[model samples]
Target: MIKIHLSRLLGERRLTQADLARKTGIRPSTIGDYYHELAERINLDHLDLICEVLNCTVSDVLEYIPSHKRKK
Candidate 1:
């Protein structure tokens, strides 16, 4: 599973989605999608903008956690 840390980061900074959207010039809906992990695909350019606004690295925003499969 790909885990997004956007919500956590925002909570740490006490920032709202609109706050980030205004600062990054990104659509509030897009940022909301990411915050809820409901985005099917992410634009790298948008990710870069978000990182810049949050002062965070790509790794800090995203994480890959391998899922465990059931054994027969």
Candidate 2:
């Protein structure tokens, strides 16, 4: 599964969802959905903005883990 580490990264950086939204110009609700891992899809533009604001790479924000079915 693709995991989003926004919450963890925010906590580690001592940032709040609102802070991220403001800095990234992304909607607060959108940020909340991502933070909670409730998002069904991600916008690349938003992702870019987030990475820029967080000063992080895409890999730092997302991770891929093979599911049981996909694991060899």
The per-prediction tally of clashing pairs is: 0, 0
**Predicted structure 2, TM vs. truth:** 0.92
State the lDDT of candidate 1 residue by residue for 1-72, as single tens digits. Answer: 788889999999999999999999889999999999998888999999999999999999998876663222
Stretches of candidate 1 off by over 4 Å are 69-72
lDDT for each residue of candidate 2 in 1-72, tens digit (9 for 90 to 100): 899999999998999999999999899999999999999899999999989988999999998887984676
Residue 68 error, candidate 1, Å: 1.9
What is the alpha-carbon lDDT for the whole of candidate 1? Answer: 0.91
TM-score of every model? Answer: 0.90, 0.92
lDDT of every predicted structure (CA atoms): 0.91, 0.94
- For this target, which candidate reaches the highest TM-score against the unseen true structure? 2
Question: Candidate 2, 60: how far from true, in Å?
Answer: 0.5
